[model samples]
Each structure stands twice: as C-alpha cells, then as structure tokens.
Target: MGKNQKKKSNKRFWWVLISVIIIVGVGSSLFFFNFFGIGIDALNNSDTAGSVEQKDLSKKEEEKINQVRSTVGESHQDLGDFVASTHEFYNDTTGYGGINNLDWEEQKNKSEQVIMEIEKLTLDVSDESLKQDLQSILNVSQQAIEEEEAEDVRSLHRYFHDLDIALNDYQSYDRIWNVTETLKEVR
Candidate 1:
C-alpha cells in the first residue's frame, strides 16, 4: 500500500477505537448507576432497598410474633380450663379410691383431648428460650396426666407442681402478654 494510504487507515483505526472506548465507558457507567431506570432496580435504586428489605423482615417477624402469641394464648385458655376441670375431678373423685374407674377414665380421656389440643397449637415462635419454656410446660402436663392415669396421686401432684412452675414461667416470660385471647380473636 502507499504510505499516505497507510497513514490514513491507521488514523481511522485509532479514531474508531477511541470512539468505541468512550461509548462503552459511558454506557457501562449509566447502566451501573441505573440512570435509565431499567433492570433489577435494586442495583442502584438508592438506600430504599435496605429499608424495603427491612420492612419485609419486620413484617415477617411480626407474623411470627403473632403466631407465638396465638399459641400461648390458646395454651392459657386450655390450661385454665384444665386446671379447673382437674380440681373438680380431684374433688369429685376423692372418695373413689383411685383413677381407675369409668368416671376417672372419662376425665382421663378429656385430659388427653386437652393435650391433643395443645399439641395442635401452631408454635412458630422465634425465641428459642420461649419455645423451650413452653415445651417444658407441655412436658410437665403430659407427665402429670400420665401419673394421674397410673393412679399415683402423689406423683400426679408432684408433676402438677412442676407444671405450675412452668406455667408461672410462661406468665412471667412477658408482661402484657395475651395469647389465647388473641388466638380467639384471630379465629
């Protein structure tokens, strides 16, 4: 090729390269900053993303809290009824000698139903400690029922005492807490 032609070709190549570089740089910058408001929208939309995510997390946490509250509330209602029923049963059966008779069997069946109801409670609690505490109460109640069925009044009373402690713990776990009523309300 001629020298002038070669020089002109080289100049054109350099101009194209420079122009391409500039275009690419500007386009990439715009895309990264979301100046055109396209794509994921989360890429560079602002700090609202954090806030949005936070709000979502907050909502989920609230839902969990409500669920736990509901379970606890159900527990309270059932436990109150159970306590009353048990006290009445104890009083009624004082002369029966043991809980092995038909009347005691009926009471035992009712207690089992209560246990099942408690088991059916949805426990979506976030706090591990609270969950453990609630589970402890359930365990005690189960043991007490078992002891009562075995016709061991002393053991039943002991288990009931432990259950009472767990119940107290649950009550003191949080003040102004009302779970059963909330569950009723939700339903």
Candidate 2:
C-alpha cells in the first residue's frame, strides 16, 4: 500500500475506536445514574411513600391482644421445656447407654402430662389458627404415646418433627409481634 493510503486507513481506525469508546462510556454512565439514583430516592422517601397507617389499638382490643400474647408465650415456653426434657430422655435411651435403660412408665406419664397441658392451652387459645396447631400437636403426641414398642422409632421422630415445626411457627409469630411493637414505639 502507498504511504498516504496507509496513513488515511490508520486515521479512520482511530476515529472508529474513539467513537465506540465514547458511546460505551455514555451508555454506562446513564445506566449507573438512572438505576442507583432511583434506588437512593426510594430509600429516602420510604417513610412517606406507600406507607400503611396503623391505627392505635383501643383499650379493650389492647387488653385482649396482650392476654393472647401472654397465653401464647407461656404455652410456647411450656412446650419448649417439654421438648428439652423429652430430648434428654431420648438421648439417654438411644445413645451409647442403649434403649435397655429406658423407663417406659415414666415416659408415658410425661406424655400424659404434656397432653393435659396442651389440651388446656388449646382451650385457652382464642385464635383459631393457633388452636388448630396446638390440637394437631396434641393429636400427634397422643399417637406417639399409643405406640406399643420403642422399636418403631419413626413415630417418635415424627412427633419431634411436628414439635419443631410448631416451635418455629411460635418463634416467628413472636418475632413479628416484636417488630410491630417496635414500629408502634417508633411512631
């Protein structure tokens, strides 16, 4: 190629490269600013925008809610204690110590006591959903108690699984209640 032709071609390549770079840089900056600027604005305006107004609870309603909370909290604690005790009993019977050391009558009595406590809690619970959950747990525990032999360990495991799920639900409810209470205080 001639020297003049080569110089012209190099100039054209440089121009095209610079043009592409400028286009890409502009596109990137536009995207960055548009996306993040809206995000920051939304964060700043969150309290005012699309906020739900929570009305203050009436005296009677407040008392009822507090009573429900107390009952549920107490029941949750009782269930937790029962679970811990049962777990210890399970570990002692099934661990290296072996099932031979298990006291069947003692286990039966404990199961009866838990069933009685759960029945009372179920009656006291005004929330139908919570009442149903307690009833379900109680039914499962009753089934576990009726099993004739410890050889079928699956029943025991099923009872524990249901108990764990109930405990998690209770904990989640407690956390939600706490968060709402905190928000009320903030307002």
What TM-score would each prediction reach against the true structure?
A: 0.28, 0.35
- Give the TM-score comparing model 2 with the true structure, all chains together: 0.35
Best by TM-score: 2
RMSD per candidate (Å) reads 23.0, 17.6
Clashes of each: 3, 0
Those runs of model 1 whose alpha carbons end farther than 4 Å from true positions after fitting are 1-104, 122-157, 165-187
lDDT of each candidate versus the true structure: 0.43, 0.48
- Per-residue accuracy of model 1 over 1-187 as CA lDDT, tens digit each: 9999999999999999999999999989877545443334334422222211112224444454456545553455545344444544543543232232325465456556646755654244444444454454466556656665433332333233223323332231121212222212222
Could you tell me which 10 consecutive residues in candidate 2 have the lowest summed lDDT? 173-182
lDDT of 2 by residue, 1-187 (tens): 9999999999999999999999999999779756443333334432122223324445554444555545543466655455555545554444332332346676566567767877765554554555555565566557657874544232343343334333322231121111122122222
Which ten-residue region of model 1 has the weakest summed lDDT?
46-55
